[model samples]
Target chain A: MRRQLLFTALGAAIALTSPLAGAAGDELNFDAYREMLADGNPAELLEMEGEELWRTARGPKNATLEQCDLGRGPGVVEGAAAQLPRYFADTDKVQDLESRLMHCMEAQQGIPSAEIINGQFLKGERGKLAALVAYVVTHSKGKPIAIDLSHPRVKEMYDMGERAFRYRTGAMDFACSSCHSQDGKRIRATQLPNITKPEGAAEGWSSWPAYRVSNSQFWTMQHRLWDCFRQQRTAEPVFASDVTIALSVFMAGKGNGAEARWPGVKR
Target chain B: MKKLFLALPLALGLSGASADELQTRVEQMMLDSFKANGIAGLDRQKQDAVQKACSGLTPPDAETMKKLEAAEMATIKWPTDGNFTGGDWKEGQKIAASGRGLTWTDKTADNNGGGCYNCHAMDPKEVSEGTIGPSLEGYGKLRGSSEEVVKYTWGKLWNSKAYNACSDMPRNGYGGILTETQIRHVMAYLFDPASPVNQ
Candidate 1:
């Protein structure tokens, strides 16, 4: 894979330039360097694989996920991710992209619900959930988030998510707001996006289903939330649970109207 | 007049119940939402008294904070040998810079990173250090070891919340994030003249 080559090349590059980064009073300009690498991001590979999986038919039902209705309708993935964690009338529950995909996987493709829900994100080699999420989110590229808060369930979820955002109960006493509420904050070399305001939330919300260079795999919003809780030292949230959906509703609502840039690349 | 007084108090209680109910629901949902997997377990959902107080809409009162601080202070296990800066600076550097441990991905909990670089500038040479906490670049150079300074520094490392109730820093000692030997190494990384942090 090109990513494998990129990693090899980068390793050599780091080895050669190790002396410069090790000097006294040297600012690595790592953020700018990351920006340069972002241009030819290898997320394109996952996007290609996702497109194939989305269109191809597999599983017991032997049917494509193309018929899986996101928010707009069946097979209408365009801009659907942005509007999600919204209430679906049929399911009668607010659902994010991963939960909805799980629904379609079981209902349409005949995959066992347990099979999909059991895997912990990033605990092992990347799960199929990450691949499927990458496929679905790529469809909504270059669109604005449009969460529907009118539905009663959606309204309830949004309220719960707001509380969840500020609900700081962990070994370290961290909430989503602890790290994300403040702007211009970083954890080591990484700059954390503030999810409090629309502009900040836009940057935060719309860039998941991203390719991670560290592990050479893609991550979804579900995995992203899971990691936040991990770093917060909270209980690992179950896949597609009410709490995860509630947090999604809160973030998606905050990030409303921001452009959806998925299959994103991260260092 | 009697009916009005009773009704008003009932209404106030009902309003209070709504927020209480939401809190209970979210807490229960969190308990139900996660399961024990790998090294992480459901017990992590359970919050301690300090965690519970900090989770509230308002900060804990000074009286409550003093009690919590006292409890936290008791958890710090001071090195019996009375040597704080005896560990190797190279080993200390590795522990201070590491940010991985206790997550599901990790196989074991031993040798967890202090994650100090994530929030503090340990050395002036590193550009990538975080700014959430104050810089400690010349920590030893600035403050030479009086018995008072050494003891205070060791206490701060053991339980930061013992000094500040709502510190963003983890109760590294009380929370069991690092071991006594590891903390000693970190202390050396801070106090040793040969360490880059002192330079």
Candidate 2:
């Protein structure tokens, strides 16, 4: 089968307006496809589930995440994810939204961090976390990415992230820069965003935590980064590790002022 | 090794010592963050001289480039048997097309793919090719199978950095990404008249 024709059985309407009919539609334009699925994004379902999980009283402590602080303040979900991967004074660690959420779950709800950390994606505790992520990022939709690198630790993470981006190792000898540093590049028809630049960083950073049509699952940014490392043929970074958070800090800080398009749909 | 960097700054009283400090810290961070899983291990995180040299913001100096290339060239394991293009082109097609192996979930390291199509266009019919490297559609047809051309191609596939110091192409043979027989098969896929790559 042609690679571009490998569209999933999501929307029957997509099949009707298939891009294959046109001469110029040889390759799938993800931008156009994203727009097509805008009204009916599957991430909305996960968002709803996340909202319920947020307010519900569960976990060992029998507490909801309603009082969890997401950088803005306790229980402030609006525009919070836009400025994530920031240094949290309470934890004294630079954390992304997922990592921050992990803290909240652990502290407020008495949920062990190990459960989510060691768990696989779209299953059990990790799966619930994915939903929560979808919910949290939904509030930050259309808000500018405003990461603060003023803190010394956050600055260190940003520096670490920049170095990590160029640090090529593994069997493939591939770095994030190998494919992403250049503009207008692709890996077998898929457009690789040039994440070094602000626009590219925004495009890459903001549109994730997405619902994938291929796998039929919502993937958090941690899952996305994990898979990137997997494809790089390097050892997997632990869930919400410093390396992952540092990489996030680099991308988010570089992507500051770009609008968040959270709960995105992807092929 | 860890203390050496910390001691250097204090000993020399250097003002801008954070460059080496950052490198050390990042290396330690990677070691701490990543854990070995199945086929993939923490050992892969450690960068060799060639990898480290090429990973810098700028390419290594001309002298260093030559040294790196020479060192990489020494690592290529040339086919013991003179016959390079005798392998099946059909098997080569599968090897080039696949982008699997060495990942954590992968069962074993053997039978890994060359992942050629990820960067270069091999078969004209295969539209799912990346434009990172030049197209190899008419590789054999354009460059005939002379002894020099065959040897050059073999070495190139084995370790691309041998020819170009910081070539983006992976060191397939030197890196143990593909086996000798698998590379031979890929050679056939590139040079064989019956191969779709030539057509």
Candidate 3:
């Protein structure tokens, strides 16, 4: 009778855990299918158009983005996107690619930053900015994510981001950490990566400017961060805001050495 | 009197007035309690056939489950050109990391993210990742470049329900979360030996 009981208990255990064990195989198949569609990504067209916009003189002053400095020297576009959300001495604030781009448009091209930020992603001058970012970010593809937090201001932003990540408030009492701090958590089958660990940070930070399959549109890093704030039920993030850049610094700094894969695809 | 007593038990069993009824009633109550606002509508409360099947007290029976899986398989949208792999891996990595777009507050749906990190571990050095899925550390290394592997990943992303009838994964491609180009880049992030996911 004891032996029979043991066998029954074992069967129950297997039944309970089988779903978790089977999930790995299911995910592998999904990954493979996504791989097959990698070629001829439509985002390429956006990248190309973005490249043209970068060099073309536009805005009130009709200045090209080629003269913009992305922390590298002026006119140097290589690998600049990888080391963003860094401290810019001139601005005296931590800035990422989008914010820095806004500064360039305002100061260099004489276009008001408000006009661009107020517009939608693909509308008016904001669309032009998105294209420019798409073009610029693609150039740094395959490089490692290496945000510099060595500066005191950059470090301060990283610390602020860490605090923001853990600050739990809202109807669901959700912070970024609520969904991202734990391993093996899921909401309606959607897996949530633990963002507190190195692998998670690298994976999370490396893919931005991705094409969202759900909406059939490309998203930039700025848009990506803003959406996170919205999901947290926090106030909508200001476009190219410092808090957003700080979060980028925190994720990118943690993701050191992870290869940059911008313009990624997503479900 | 004797017939009534016999019929009472039968009625209880046939009517499913036990645990199953209680569970369904609870779910209904929960669904009804929530109100739809803005872009979020009552449709969110409605479960599809697959969801209903999965929510049952027991796992789906094998025969019915097989039929559901087949139905999901039919929904996959394979690339027309047959070019399964393209786009720069660097570009792909960015999309995987971002978890943005698709909410009631979103003014527009022009930009969105893959939110891949919400589930699986992709890179070795990074600190934050969710573990709902397996550690994708060295995915390319473990599974070499075989045609079968490539095709399977693409299909899974397109419609996860194809393989597993009640899979928790979002139907990225089928549900229109990521575009073809975006899917391509995410593919590069996974399969590109150069991608950090591979490393």
Residue B134 in model 2: lDDT: 90
On TM-score, the candidate that comes out on top is: 2
* Correct interface contacts retained, every candidate: 0.53, 0.73, 0.05
Give one digit per residue, the lDDT tens place, for model 1 in A1-267: 776887777556445544335543334324444455566556666666767777878789998888889888889877777788777777877889888888887788787768767765654213655666776777788888888765556766776787777776655567787778777777776777888787887887887778765676667888888888888777678888888888888888988888887767665
Scored by DockQ, the top model is 2
The lDDT of each candidate is: 0.76, 0.87, 0.68
DockQ of each: 0.34, 0.46, 0.03
Candidate 1 local Cα displacement, residue B163, angstroms: 1.6
lDDT of 2 by residue, B60-163 (tens): 99999999889888988877879778889999999999988889989998889988998888998777778788999989999999999999999999999999
lDDT per residue (tens digit) for residues A1-267 in model 2:
322232343556566665433413244456667787887777888898999999999899999999999999999999999999888889988899999999999999999999998998889888999999999999999999999866666777888899899888898888888888887777877778899899888988999999887667789999999999999989988999989998999999999999999989887
What TM-score would you report for chain A in candidate 3? 0.86
The segments of candidate 2 whose C-alpha lies over 4 angstroms from its true place after superposition are: A1-9, A17-26, B1-17
Model 1 regions more than 4 Å off: A1-40, A120-129, A169-174, B1-17, B79-82
Model 1 vs. true fold: TM? 0.85
Local error of candidate 3 at B128, Å? 23
Steric clash pairs (candidate 1)? none
Q: Per-residue alpha-carbon lDDT of model 3 for A16-130, expressed as tens digits?
A: 4433344543452233433533553446667888888878887789888888889988977789999887888899878888888889888888889999867667677777777
Specify the CAPRI tier of model 3. Answer: incorrect
Per-prediction TM-score of chain B?
A: 0.88, 0.89, 0.83
iRMSD values, candidates in order? 5.5, 4.8, 19.2
Tell me the TM-score of each prediction against the true structure: 0.85, 0.92, 0.54
